[model samples]
Target: MVSRTGLYPGTFDPLTNGHLDIISRALKLVDTLYIGVAINRDKGPLFSLEQRVEMVEAETKALSDGSNSVIKVVPFDTLLMSFAEELKADIIIRGLRAVADFEYEFQMVGMNSFLNDEIETVFLMADPHHQAIASKLVKEIARLKGDITSFVPADVASRLNEKFGN
Candidate 1:
């Protein structure tokens, strides 16, 4: 039987609990999951690629245990569909937070389907508590010396604090 693998791609500038929630839920639908960190040059990410990868690796280490053990955190600089094709991922997992997100994700799903007909996209609704949490907002709040402990992981919070010299 073919191994079922899913690709969850995102910038993940600083991994957050909402992201963790999505990752945890995505694992249940596929035998293996690749959390792809997008290396988008245009975004001017606050964290370096290496730092983002390390943070994701550290955060997901606990999920790499047990019989199913097939979680991978990797960096992808190419198009998401190309990365999914290269990794032989059968599905692309995305998290939907609100109606605005739905509209954008809808267009993306259509484009992704057009790029690779065989691969499917799966959308998971964010948990109610996480519905309003976004990485951009988290970063802004953190930059302004606001409390971001509730939005991201402790390690990420520490990193943000250190980055902002808080």
Candidate 2:
């Protein structure tokens, strides 16, 4: 409760239900949450930046009904911590699902802390049901013509299928 604002940045090629869980949990811990949609061309995102932003907006519409419905979606070029600073956010909310993610996030947290000593990073473990769902895995499964209906929201799954020609 110390920090009222948080920045939650991610590729969100197409927002999934797992991402929804993280956003929902982070909402409880902060007054405002900035869901940053970073457009990294090097990543070769499945969806365009505008499409990703639209999906993120749709997925977060429920938050608009909350008392602190202060979630905003924005595009970022790079440097996540720099984006946080620009948003004047005091905390960065990260979603961690498995042990493998810990290593990468840990290093990033340390680097972000070094960049902005006053900014804090908080990691939220994904819900047990969604611990295995990730954007990469979802894409891989779609490419293989596997069912990922459970891994993402309905709209996202449809978009993924269409994008991958499944």
Candidate 3:
């Protein structure tokens, strides 16, 4: 049996619940799920790459334990498709929360398809309950002392609060 591997790439600047939702769902679709923590210096991430990777691993621990699939959190400093190619992934998982996301991701799919026709891009719609949760907005809410408990996990919320000195 050919094992299916997938790469889910994102900055994951604090690892929100929405990301966790996608990770949990992605596990069911592939034999191995690689959570690619992108080292995007342009985003000016709130958490360092190590921190992001650690947070992903920590949060997904339960998911990994419960599922039959293997889950690995890896940091990447290269282009997304290049990293996927490096992992020899069969698919790239993306989560779409809204039409706005679709517009961007649709373009990405087209470009990535051109990059590697062998690797497929799969889109998972965000659960409606988590549709509005975004890492950047979560950070902004945390910075302003707004409730972020719903947007992130408890550990992530605490980390965000600590980062904001809240």
* Candidate 1 Cα errors over 4 Å, as ranges: none
Q: What's each prediction's TM-score?
A: 0.96, 0.94, 0.98
Residue by residue across 1-166, what tens digits does model 2's lDDT show?
3548899999997677889999998998888889999899999998999999999998788765664648899999969878888999988999999999999999998888889889999999999999988899899999999999998888888988998888
Candidate 1 TM-score over all chains jointly: 0.96
Best by TM-score: 3
lDDT of each: 0.92, 0.89, 0.94
Please identify model 2 stretches exceeding 4 Å from their true place. Answer: 1-3
Error of 3 at 45 (Å): 0.4
**Candidate 2: residue 123 Cα off by (Å):** 0.5
How many residue pairs clash per model? 0, 0, 0
lDDT string, candidate 3, 1-166, tens digits: 8899999999999898999899999999999999999999999998989999999999999999999999999999998889999999999999999999999999999998999899999999999999999999999999999999999999989999999999
Task: Give the TM-score (vs. native) of candidate 2.
Answer: 0.94
Indicate whether candidate 2 or candidate 3 has the larger lDDT.
Answer: 3
Give residue 111's error in model 3 in angstroms: 0.8
Q: What is the lDDT of residue 151 in candidate 3?
A: 90
Give one digit per residue, the lDDT tens place, for model 1 in 104-165.
Answer: 99999999989999999999999999988899999999999999999999999999999999
In candidate 3, residue 21 scores what lDDT? 96
